[model samples]
Target: MQMSNRIKEIIEVILNSKGYVTIGEIAKQINVSDRTVYREIPEVTEIMREYGVQLNTVSKKGMAAVGSLEDMKSLRISLGMEKQIYIVDPRERIDFILLYLLQQDDYIKTEALAIDHHTSVPTVRNDLKKVKEQLGVYDLHLIQKKGEGILLTGSEIEKNALMINILLNHADEATLYQWLRREGDVSNPFTKRMEEYGYLDVMSACYLRMKNIIRDQCELPAMIKDREYLEYILLIAMMIGCHQKGQPYEKVFETENFKGEEQRVTRQVKRELEEEFHILLSQEEEQYIKWVLHMGMIQDTSSVYTVKNRILDSKIHTFIEYVEDRMGLQLIRDKELKESLYVHIERALTRIRSGMCISNPLIEDVKKDYEELFGIIREGADRIFQDDFFPDDEIGYLVLYFAVSLDKVMKRSFRILVVCSGGMGSSKMLAHRVEQEIPEICVSKEVSLVGFGQENLDEYDLILSTIPLYIDKRNYLKVSPLLSSNELEQIHEAIKRHKYKTMRKITVREQERRQLESRDNIESLETLRLLMDTGLRVIRQFRIVETREKDLKNNLLRILSEESLCSLPETEEKMKKQQSYYIPVTDMVYYEAVLARMPEPKLFAAHYHDDQYLSNGEKYTDVIYAVYPDQASEYEKNILNRMLESVIEDRDIQEMIHRADEKGVRQWFGYQFKQYLAELLAV
Candidate 1:
């Protein structure tokens, strides 16, 4: 035996003797690293399973040797044979190279083959020879040079020809489909060829089914299905047997009828199965299918009668009564197989056979309880929005609201803030429920009714009211008469009917209206922008003229000390003109005067006034003073940029500035000015 075989044997003995050997122990016994020992376990387990030997783990902390000594010996022998690589015929070397390339790294590195193949440089060279030989088979070339090393070179269109050949010759149809499903990009030439050959659709369906089955049957161990065969049979069965046309069995059921029967039989079997085994079937319909297959395959008439009697037995009846008492399902009354009734019955039987049962009934009892709880909340939110008194139960209703909320987030382009009064927990509940309804309309910020008066409501696109909030704001879009689940459904329908494009158009119209108003509002924005630009200019001047030490001190002193011009105290006389004034910039008086003019003037100052250069006014004499002027250095430019930033903290304005910068405005201006100078000289 090889050295690797001997090491593997010693590790296995330690694992069997210890019941659970640590990585360190395995390494010490086998003379390998802990990683090697850990990696070997999975490989060894696979080899052992083929020989009827089992390895079981206890809580993933301990291992157990499950089979007898004889079983171990059989597994050891099988494992030795399994580890050996099958030799490729010389003619089939190209097929091997194609397989190898399929498993290659992201970049086709020509660094000698990866160590795992356990081959020398010369052996790898010979392997490349085989690979090159195979490329010729596909009318392609294996390009190699001293520095460039090896590369598979060919027209992208013909590249897949060799891969297809290998798939056809070396791999089974099912394996080929599985491989293509994972590695073959649909847009790739190879995948397109497969699709053109009509194999891709079947492969996709098989892959989808496999994924669905894994997700649905959580506890069931994965079983590798022959995807191609499964897809072919399923398609035929769906087309023929489901249609009940030209089939061996004349009474073949259509999809609808089959579905109905499945529901009915499933409910019946579930009831009986639950009574006998007490296992609650997690996936009732899937379990029903298995039961149906078992029923279809029955050979004995006596067995059929025995099973049928079991379905109608008193034990089953008693269990049904238990389900009713616990879950409020009066099952005895509903003799007709309704969808839910059939589903419940099937699930019940499935649970019994599986030996895992839950007392929770499959009827509407659960839904009813949740519905009643949320209904009360919906009523409270509606009443609160209407300015009615909130009841004591409003707090409990709030929790249910969030539980039923939508599980999506706002899109990047839009944002909305939800505001509500503190009482009855209506604000939280409304926020929860609305988020549930329209996920894209996020509650970016939540403000209580008390603090809501303090919020800058202009930031949000939509203002949803749980109550009729009267603040003299007209721009807000309101969905009134706060909604229940039914009402919300109506709102959703209205929104969908309106369409996203229409909503966007409305948003655009609103924006345009704001833009018109901005003309009057531009002075305040201009003054703000000037302030930011001034601050940035001051910093830039200090950086360029003063040493690092002086620059730091100057910045510190500027922030720490207040100038008389920066601070303006409000008198009671001036306070009368404005009910309240929260000063944002040093030139509050100037800013307020700008705001007083309203929409039109403000728009001109903000949009039309090109004040980016800080050249609009004299140093310290203008709304903002520039720190440096002579050289107009980068530092001075940075200061001007900062003042403009402070002018408006709005994200949209900043984004506009960024776009302007990207357009190379300075370069454009220089080119135009130079051209004008040349024209002047010519004149």
Candidate 2:
């Protein structure tokens, strides 16, 4: 006899407590009334009698389990509470019902489900409604027949797909890894649930062989390095197991037309699986496996520039452009954003085309924080794809990419100095953790305690030390080298306080500057003098032209030579050594920015009218070439940062710079410099 969830909780409380637990305590713990607890006592007593255990109730102390430890263990296992916590949450119950129905070959009575979950038939019926809605997404149906019961009916492939989705949603990577290795916790609720559904048997049959096959492949080692690859491997094992059971995937697609390294790898994998499992695979199965491997490769590889899918590529470009227009922000210039979105969407589209659903666990949080952006991207994606396949989960992933891009544009990075008493290894580790946890912070320097005493602390925005300091506590925060969660919270609070103080100081300075400005024209002339001296030098070196050349190095050489900013051979040598200096801004307006060191500060910018693809496969119509001296002043750096900020933040400035001629570009720069100086003085 299956015990109800309430009875299980009561028994657990008694077994775990050192002394007897009162009826009122049990009632409160399980959120039930004392009268209800009294009503269930007889049933609990009867259930314990079968396991050789007795439920003993004292006069005023309430009840306790009086039996051998062995009997108590047996009773816990019988109640499914030996290793797992018995949960009565509605969602978990609904998931249990779905899994139960899918694993059964014939109809099961509604009363049976009610009995298994220890709930009312009416509660089970409500859960079935949600189960039916979820199944409909996979084109599966929950059929109810009079007098017989209910069953899940769908293609085997669809059933398998839904099963994988549920498994991934319930269990995390570490748990799945443990399960595949046969070291899984028997007490884990998800593990026990999988055992009940008979999936563990399927996993056991093919896991070892699949692991060996994937491990042997040279290309797969990199892919499997990520824990997420375990999910794919588990899915493959399940598919092979299903085929061995004579329920092969029946959907037919053309397998003969596929080509490339991924296809070759798929063929080898198919041969090995067929031989090991003693089952002949269908053409559709071969194609499905090929698609799965292809997605794995996409996830592993960084650059998808060489692997071209013209139709999907076009759709991605259109999607980016649509988002750009709606948000009035320039996202196309963000190289990492474009590349990452391309890879993600490519895999997403493949999943949709293959009738596989994608799950985003953070979908709710993404919607909450980025509600407006999520809606805009959803509409844009739906309109671009012209289909209903793009679910909110997929759109949520897309929103994260744009949200990160916006943060990069808008965030003010803080410079951090890390001081640790430990060796360089521990100091570096702490620094890495800091950057990982707080994206808005940059670890500018790492120093030992001795080195810290000799350096100027005012250069850094915040100082994090591993050891306690002799100076004022407010000057630095003490954190563990490992940076525990509590220490991380302390650092966050410190940063917030620092930001508030900085803003207050700025406000005070602005008030003082305003009072001085009203007194005389002396300060006003000083601002103009500073702008004319440094800002004019940068604007004077700006150049714009129409070019058809695709080679960025050659274009930079010609422009720098014309302006006589630096030696041609020196610039060429530097360009060859560090190609990272060529920063691609955007494909929407087509611009690249290059930075290098020179004897004097200089900025050489070119606006090309003709569109051309560079050697890196990115199209460009504008290039801003800048060179700064090794000892350039902070004011010079600020001017350059302001220029780039204007191009990114001001749409009108971007258009003016794009359409303006050489002299026109210089005049626009001079006007922008005046505005920059005014804002600087005001701040």
Candidate 3:
């Protein structure tokens, strides 16, 4: 960690540059000798690693930092170069100073704060004045405790929000994620910085330990999937995880209100907090968990509203209409979905009014998973609440409401056969897992390896076999007996294959196609949606379901063809007919689709790569990716056409396709996506 000034300068230069730089170039820029530059290279590399940066060297191509933009942002904080990099200015320092004061249990001496920040006492006093003004924003206050130095006061939740805000303002998503990963690892470079940010080692570790315990010992609902949100609530558990000396003056919690599931989560969480962190959760802390999980805690909606729904009926209806228009889905009519959204908004508004800021750990996941829908709801909320910008956490709840509602109406479930090894114990366990985890797929029968041969495989739309089969088939995936995350992903993709296949069949019916074709003036976005109607969407993730010695490429191509996106035969014929066009792009593994789009091509390709290698080193895995392009606008062709060309050349394009929110994925194929991608990719 003791790096020379020259070495630090080299890192700063390399980090600032997007492309690689030669050693000679680096030495010349820094005005150092070639030998000095060479000598410092090792130290520079060590420095980068110590600061969470991976220096990528392309041999003769020279070196540059290889990581996300968030990593680079974290690097500034890691090295204490935040000041040098202008990562946080004086005005921002005041905000952090305020957060520090708020977290103080007793009055913190103003002189001590000044010394800590390397500023003079008067400057610290001036900072406290500004801090007071800033706390006013969260409806909090700075007060002088009698017989103590200086105290900052706020409601417990508001104080917690200030702490969370301070942490988030300095740390990016990658930093927050690394903080969790660094838990219990004392030697971690991030550990020192995390403590510097006010998280005690025992407390932070307790949050993560509790998470693993819950996953192993209990079954959690799907809505409880966000890791950040989990950690935030656990942070609450950590805060409340201390020995209590006295009882509450008044009991507000009605134990009768907690259904079986809420009671289960509360009991397990309470026991773990006591054993792991040594603090029995007070009733208030128990209530915190229930409040945090309200989105998931509401078990039955069968109860008639004894109280008028928390949110205004008219406001919910208007918001629903806006969502329907933007998303092109009917949500307003779904009574169940409307009620769900209503209760969430009502509870959220009540919390917001009380200065209680709840964090959504899965906000990133939700945004990544449902980008466009999130955007529409965000816009809708802004319209409804003219005075305030809705928090992302609230918007995340809306995403959950609509995603579940839409999936209920849009999804078409398929029956699958579970083919396991001869052991009934393992096969039945796998079958139970498939039923429990994958609600979308219904298992029709559980058959053994020997029994599978005798049973009618064609009766089931998809087959999941644990062992290799002699049968050559399309809708099949070979998984392990354990059924890990990797296998779950496989099951997910297989289900998509059947769903898209069915959608393709229903959409391409002569009647629907004829009616669809008659509309010529469709918006580019509408045309994009039309592709979904034509079954043109790619499976979000591709799985290696193909057997060895099989023509995986052809089988995968046939699957993509089933989507009606494009036909391999049709694209090949067009390649022969066209005089000139850009070459097609493929990763040769995950990207098995044809990416070359003509100015007025019939369809955009979206296929999966199989597990076999042809002479050219390409294989199809599961579904064929071909698109039957309808009449798209010049704008649509121009944007998506560019994405197809870029997808072949850029790794980020490939990744962003997988990781980006729905709108982000759709926009990537367009010229606009490239513009936005460049700005964020460096981070």
After TM-score superposition, what is the CA distance of residue 331 in candidate 1 from its true location, in Å? 55
TM-score of 2: 0.52
* RMSD of candidate 1 to true structure, Å: 29.9
Angstrom error of the Cα, residue 350, model 2: value is 1.7
CA deviation > 4 Å runs, candidate 1: 1-158, 161-416, 440-448, 456-462, 470-475, 481-683
RMSD of each: 29.9, 22.2, 16.6
TM-scores for every candidate against the unseen true structure: 0.20, 0.52, 0.41
What's the lDDT for all of these models?
A: 0.39, 0.69, 0.57
Candidate 3 regions with alpha-carbon error over 4 angstroms: 1-3, 10-95, 105-115, 118-139, 144-150, 168-174, 180-198, 217-221, 241-258, 295-315, 321-347, 353-355, 359-683
- Measured by TM-score, the strongest candidate is 2
The candidate scoring highest on lDDT is 2
Per-residue lDDT over 542-645 for candidate 1, one digit per residue giving the tens place of the 0 to 100 score:
21111122122232224222321232232111221212121121111011221121111110011112222223321111121122223343323433433333
Clashes of 2: 4
For model 2, how does the per-residue alpha-carbon lDDT over 56-151 read when each residue is reduced to its tens digit? 888988887777656776987886666544447777677777877878889999999888767899999999998986765576889999899999
lDDT of 1 at 108: 56
**To one decimal, what is the Cα RMSD in angstroms of model 3 from the true structure?**
16.6
Give the 10-residue window scoring lowest on summed lDDT in candidate 2: 576-585
